[model samples]
Target: MAEWRDPQWEYFAIQSLRGKSFGDEWPTIPEFFQYTVERFPDNSAFTTFAGEQRESISYRELAQYVEALARSLQNLGLTAGDRVAVSGKNSPYWGIVYLAVLCAGCVVVPLDARQNGEFHKHLAEFTEAKAVFMDGDLLAKLEEAETEQPAYRKYLIQSRKDFADATGAKWETMWQMIESRKGDTTGALSSLAQIRSDDMAALLTTSGTTGNEKLAMLSHANFTSNLIQCVYPGLQEILSTDRLYLLLPMHHCYPMTAVFLEGISHGSELIFPRGLAVQQILQDLKDGKVTVFMGVPMLFNKIIQGVLNKVKAQPAAKQLMFRLMMGISGVSDRMGKAIGSKLFSGVLKAMGFDHIRILICGAGVLMPEVGEKYRRLGLNFIQGYGLTEAAPIVTLNPAGTSEVRSVGRLLPMITGRLESSPELSAPVVSVRGHEVGELCIDGPNKMSGYYKNPQATAEAFTEDGFLRTGDMGYFDRNGYFYITGRSKNVIVTAGGKNIYPEEIEELFQLCSWFEQVMVRGYREDGTEKTELVVYPKLSEDCVARIAADRDAFLSGDTVKDPAKQEEIIGVQLHREILADVQRISRKLPDYQRIGRVRVILLSLEMTTTQKIKRFLAESRFAQHNDGLLTESQDF
Candidate 1:
């Protein structure tokens, strides 16, 4: 391994001691993980649940697996700096392959499982991946999409019974590597390929290629610096315990670095559920005794909402006690006394959060109301803000120094500057004179550049050398950052006031009736008006009543004509949903009030990170109707 030091010595010199040592600053990703292994060789390292099988591996065992895989790849005529692709659901095997590829001095390409096969193919060719490791489903998809045989070597995550490709061929299995090296592994586990700190560690695709590849290229130094920055008073505060809940997909940068690799850095075990199936997640929490849980906005929104709904269904006396405890807990939280653990201890245990210490939500916007509920219920709730280009982490809510509304302060040794986005006309929206500009950051953790796309790379950074994050935000008197909305997502009113649809959308998010809501401005009769597109989620009571009415109609006990009854039910549900939205949305100012509404039956499409893809949704609505808002009725 190369002994790399910070090129910008002057900048690193003033940083706090928190980031001093990480087995040396120039450590490779494999070396860093190995360092943790040396610290806790006998500790439980990884655990995963898949269907009927449950597996656990120790740090020492995991190191041997990585070495075995690297040796296998070496025997196959591959050397350092080769590219390998791994695709599968979140499992311990996926993680093992990911680390093993790096251990062999190969750059890993992690593709999103939700993406299409053609996109995946394009990523493989763009990165020139020499080999691919995939599960049965992905292998089938790859086979169907290709007319000619692919040149890359193939490996399987798990063996498929009697499975054959187009040529009736069987691929090698990942488990074989472990079996071959079970014993009599002397020279195999001893030496590793020489890796430099500046070598490319991974290539992460941001979007579909348009003939110009725009994969975010991160270096070994980039990964190491971020790991050190995070370990030193970074995530180490939350991940100090032994076990962490790996909830999100490993392909996404947030989970890959912040949760997965962060856990390895601290010798904390990871729990990967069978799949993201609802019941599986609950069961995994119970079985794994997860200590740190990291997720996005949707995860916490549903979990917290589920617990609250259960509380409401309790008997009157029990409900009264729960409410009283919650009230007292809220008061105690304000006074810096964490009493929710004792007050709502039963609620926590019931939800399988008996061992949960910290709950970190990132990758999407988290509604403040949901965050407050968790905090009041005695969970340490945190919100983070970042983009893929920054190796995906720029700012996270500090454990003890967190603020309710802010996204916490910038990471230590990371510099954030607010650059004027006069084009968006986001007029310093604060009265206290804080500049509201596109949040641009400068840090060693930032990516080198977009892969082979100089035009895109040039546009990503400013002349002054900060990566322009294209996110419109402002900073408080303290160094904490606040994101208002994306630059392209902002809507300007005729009155020349900047209106962030996210702000208006957040107000409606407080109500569960609207499953998905988006606020956008449309021109109608030469006037720009605010419009809301909604997908309704029926209340439990309303759904039950509707089902009961349908059953009575079917039995011919309530209505003479079933079709008319169905029509009436649909109309009633629409009215109920509209009324609920109107009641909740009235809290917004007159200017921010929605002037029109469009109700779609289907839910809006979201990104892998669970963010609603706004432009695509608008296009979908436009394709189906002449106007996005069919009914220009305002409430």
Candidate 2:
């Protein structure tokens, strides 16, 4: 099959060992899992914090546990076509339970643990789940939901010590059930009989980049195709002995597919972090000897800032030497990987990333400058583009062939198109250089539909069946995709020109003072105007210096001088920030230019993947309109 296909997909049955097949006869997820278990039975499959102790489970052991749990669920009178929901943070037990549910031929629903109680209840009821396996802390919400929506027959609690009291009478500890079964694999083969390749395997909720969220009904074939078509080709160079560090929540499709599932399929050791604290992550990186590090842009930005801060604290001569070394590394990277990898080993090892061979970035747009910096530093950092709807991977930059600015080439067996709208009559998309448009995808990995919501499912696709990805992007001549922004987020000026806030924000990423930036339009006299809100992360030493100077002045000491006042320091900092904003604003158009800028002292609320909740901040700006800069009402 060609990489790109027509709008009306031609489906064919795929061949497989299990006698089950999808379009063109492809093997399903269970078949793939069977293959992996047989291939790497003795390898360590997963590791995570169990209570205060770190627990490691081998592939063979994990397979046995999954089978036993499947048997237990079957014995409880749960049928093959039932819905089971799993809500929690990433853990080895979560992985085992997820696979076990699928092995029993039930559709798995992985909910975002961070969602509000109302949204969580709505989704559980929407999916019509028969059973739920949740982190014990969230049991109360489910119990409340059962009162209004009584479909669920059981609730299984994850045994975290703090949440023991939250469990209900219907609850059973996941690990306890598996332990009692004692590796019984009696009905494992028979359970596989009930599963079909095209049946819904998992229901992953969309990130809700727009207003509301919907569940994508992905099949065993959908996920398995993604594993083979997207993940395998990108990881061709990565070895089975490599260790992949899993930091983000595993329920997220990016980490679930790229890090967790890929590691299991490739026989790599997956090391789960105890938490997201930088200090803890650093220790885990050193202790686990993690060879593959994957994360979102925000986490990488923090790590880079931390490294630079440490470098700045060193003496003048050391700083000069480091800069010279970085220059050499940049030159080597421009030359190619063979030269760069060998030349930058010393610097990379000093930064504690020596063992890391690949760094996969996803979730949100990774700044090009950051990608370039890591490339020069000898870590093969590459961007991956996908969503939960496509089993989360459609494209990944191949090592050695990657470009800094682009998000890499499309993966095998995937087809993409761009349109002005979701309608079939919508114009064919084009771009000036790397300009973007609404990105659409069609492939074997594409989802079946939004689960149980026919209206939403119908709205999510074009008449010709292309998945309408609310994301806007354009592809270069080299087939490298560059995401500009979301269609809903584009700021339109009075002149009718569209501007992406992310483009403007990317320009400010290199600025040292600004910690976070969000650009939006404010309404004035029924007209829209652009504004920028910035959260400045001041240097700790600078804050201390200002505090000391203020304290000394207030003490009425004769030694205190007005020239060294805290107010003076504040004025100087403000001037520097104004200059930086002006420099960036020059690149933007007149209407799109920032009119109001505010420097916030506190960090903004962010998602688990580190994307700022724009709607929350937008509402805050409206509530405190007095703090913002505004033009005259006449304008």
Candidate 3:
């Protein structure tokens, strides 16, 4: 009950807003932006960075563009409630289009531009979108396919290029449309006034990483409320002075609400990297002085891993010194002193993180070690948990008093309960829980329902109206939630033990030899057992160590034939990996321990967010030969 109280920072954050009008929440996202634009008209709202060059639009300037574009859409025969699809890479222009559609009182359907034509086509037809604003290249792909396009009444290009010649149609560029209608008279504002807070604002498709796609319907209140929820819980300190980095795909809800919407709502500068390249992001981070960085676990792990790898390559004395410094920083952390920034100033500057105020990871499981390493390095790092159905933000670790082991404490005003029952519609085998089970949530930020799929909408919630999160997790005594794994991904062993692959996969993440890892249950001798499929990323040191073990195994009579070298290496690799697996498995419960191990050279198939597609991974490698270095089970 103590955890259910209003967030401590809410009063302070709300009072700071102009006239303290946004105490609970704004009626709509448009109204919130309107307030911000009026409050910080000249403040930089959106910025795009490309190496040393950048472009920006102030809040006032962006509002003008949004108003013009909204009028342009209305003039082009679009009306209120019309579905408009917007697909593009992350950019200020993309944000403008998204806001403009909402301004026109139309539902914004944010489709994944990285998806293939068929995928785009399916979403368009599924939503029955009346118009589409697309990037030139993706539009070209649809035309190149020679298939009938989705029934779109108007096409607006996101790129600066006029693709009339290429497409044999006079498609208007987004900028051209906005500029041409800047002063044009329209009734768009009137329609926007009529748009209700409960109206469906955006139709977002759930990432089918688990191989299932459903369109989620989120409302204006959902988006607006969630942004408030994101802040008051911990990030109320973020101000107009902060620069929020947008690295993850903006089409996804995680970055959309966390970075894009959060930045603009706070009147902060929203910085978009020119490209997703690590170097490009680093350049932008340093040059732009971004204060907030929100990214997925994969990207964060890669970044932290790169840093640790460099430290590991250092001389023994230097490596030990670095650890000592980190330990010192950790002590300072517990003492409520932030000396990591001072302690690791050189390291921070080198990694372009010297100016970064907050580092947040979400969208996938993050190893606790990774989270601990970041804090010890003197960074304000936090992890959060959410799904699209919850307007994508259910919880955020309170910045100053974070519980790194848990995903985060529930956002202010969100109520959650754990239910232990496989009979529920959750796609899990054993919904185990005396303490852990499906996490069900209820809050104003929760989505209205799945788009047009009544059955799924019905199944997605409980009789009491709490949305079934389909994630297996439990709350700590302090209300911080720790996710075990997805309900759908639970592996039930023959001994009636449940194995959460993500939990085991995190242990493997601590090992430098693995690029990626996925655990699943396999049948052996008419009984279910744990098996591991891994993509190895052996370091030079790892190779040398394994080679030494191999030579010792053969009593210094190593394979002489060149052809046999590959065979010898393969056997040695399997033995080394298995030994490591056993070493790590000892920490896990006996039933959850891996019995068989398989090594694959080729990378596993992954979603754009870098989550390994579990179903696809299992089936794709089922027949591959050399990729599989199977070891006999002894567990």
Candidate 4:
């Protein structure tokens, strides 16, 4: 096995002497959960928004539930090392099922429930899941799935509704199975306790940004090592007393490792949103006394917009006070910890982040402007970079002393180096600071391989056994990593200059009118030419002005005027957006400029985390080709 080294581990070891350690070996999810239970049995584990009706399960109670579930699973004739799949939204039940399967000595396969039929079929078949636990909406698809998927043995429904027909396939509702085995099953618990740390715990799938998604095989040690890495580093700041507000989908590796597993390990209370609504999230943050806020760039953007809008509407004196306080806070944040002195605490409290000590942005690149604003507002906004394959954490900005543009220093026990790629001659292979290349990693957090796909597993690693991240980035002199773009997404112009759509898109994010943007090279004749497609979320004021102008024109109020009263406001807004794009592109080479742009009136399709689906947008742009702005055509 390749050895992995991350420098942060030693720092964590020195600071967090009292916390539990899994040693150099990784523990299975069940083992970690058990360890936490043994250490903090009385601490509150999870909470939800249905009334103040909190489900305060102590570590001991959580362990018993896991044992009970494991016993029930065992009674169903599931042997050790079998694959059990679970698909659903984030909930306490989801967490319980994940750990129970591990305790039962079975490999857990977590599937994203929002996936389409093709993705669902691919994932289920890829893992060879023996049994599947799914929600009601997904159960219908499972019925059809069994005909195509012969390896699946059972379908356990998570909802209350009964299966309309279950003649051919074996099906059981979650509640029914648990109720039937309500009596204590201590013997099964003893059987579970015999499992080892090296046992396989999960088969987490990659995001498949470049091609088809592959299942990354992870043992108990992989996840356990990652959990310890996060907890031990900032034990003093990130403690059990802090309330973690979890809004990101728990199925993804980043949130799974950073928020869910970390919270469970530390015995901190986790507050789930009532739903995905932004208003609900704001209300939850305030009411739940949330101390830790972990979210994606889109979520943070929306929250910032909400706060800014409020600031804009305030009285002149209040606005002046807020701006002055923000400036003071910014200086403090830059000059190290002692400067701000909580001068803007009242402003932050009003904006619903009073108790929030750490606001972590992961899953994608966060705009620096947003990061700076949060810092100025007295929030500890930090960015982390990793993939699903790395047990999801390779680099994270430490709570304090984080550089604005850097993704913090390299994590402990992880060795990173940039060298020339033997496969690709042009682009370099990134190792250490500032030189861009394909980011490669070899670490404990790295996945074993793609499950059941030896060909893909072999392709994932380089000749030297480093995991090819497919992401392009470089380390700065200070060891903070700055990602440029994906290697595959780089646009090579006719002039041979490389352009990254993400860099151009980041510029558009500064435009308040636009919500999302995707810049890509499309075929113009036989040559590839670049085009910009922007999804603008027009402000209410803009919308109303357009509506009023239309109303006036329709009423013939301006008929007598020879001036073309065409809704020039919309056109003017588009021009302003184009100008902003041009201003940012001045920093880039000529080939990467905004040669053409398409201002979308409707919102662009996006994932749950608010990442614009590039292919989808490309397809939509192609369908409306005539309306698009292009260099060949006049603006």
Give per-residue lDDT, candidate 2, residue 503: 74
Report the lDDT tens digits of candidate 3 across residue range 1-635. Answer: 36534556543455466334442344567767777787798999988755467778898888888889888888888877889988888878889999889888899999888888677667777888888788777777655653754478545555433333345455667877887888863423324536767888999988777666898999988988888777764444578889999888888989899888888877999988878877777888888888999888878878888899899999999999999999888888888886888888898898899998899888988888888888887888988899999989998887865457788888877899988757323333332333678899999989889988999999999999999998988777667788888878877766666678888888877666677888877787988777888777765764665556643323322333323434644655655666788789888777777787766544666766778888777666464332443555453
Backbone clashes per model, in order?
0, 8, 0, 15
> Ten consecutive residues with minimal summed lDDT in candidate 2?
626-635
- lDDT string, candidate 2, 192-290, tens digits: 547777888888877754435678888887876776665433333445788889889876788887787767766788898878888678767766778
Q: What Cα-based lDDT does every candidate model obtain?
A: 0.72, 0.71, 0.77, 0.69
| Candidate 4, residue 405: how far the Cα is off, in Å | 0.3
Checking candidate 3 for backbone clashes, the offending pairs are none
How many angstroms is residue 287 displaced in model 3 relative to the true structure, after the best TM-score fit? 0.9
Global local distance difference test of model 3: 0.77
* Tens digit per residue, CA lDDT, model 1, 1-635: 12224443322432332243232345668766776787777888888765657678888888877777777777677788888988988887788899889878889999888767786677777788899898767877877777787778778886322232234346678767656654633433323777777889998876331123368999877766676665434333634356888878888888888888878877889888766765677778878888888887777777877787787889999889888888888888888887888877877787778788777888767778778888888888778887778877888886743355777777766888877776464455652367677888888789889887889999999998899887877888777777787777777677766777777776665555667788888887776678887766755664566466554433333433334433543666666667866776677777777787766544667766676777677776565542123353445
Q: Clashing residue pairs in candidate 2, if any?
A: 12-24, 13-24, 13-25, 14-24, 14-25, 14-26, 15-25, 437-473
Leading candidate by TM-score: 3
Point out the higher-scoring one by lDDT: 1 or 4: 1
Per-model TM-score, in order, reads 0.87, 0.85, 0.88, 0.84
Report the lDDT tens digits of candidate 4 across residue range 1-635: 12223445433343353234443255556656766676677887777776655445666666666777777788888888888888878776677777778878888888888875555666667677777777656766766655564566555645222433434344566655555565764533324745665667788876644445678888777776777666434422467787888778777787778888888877788787778888888778888889998898878888888888888899999999888887877877777763443786776777678888888887788778888888887777788888888888878887865466776656667778754433332554333434677788887788878878899889788888988887777877767788777777777666555666776676555566677778888776676667887656666875565456554433334432322322432556656666666667676656666667655444556655667766666665565542234343322
Residue 120 CA displacement from its true place in model 3, Å: 0.9
Winner on TM-score (3 vs 4): 3
Alpha-carbon runs more than 4 Å astray in model 2:
2-24, 49-54, 144-150, 153-170, 186-190, 232-238, 337-347, 421-435, 525-527, 538-579, 589-591, 600-605, 620-627, 630-635
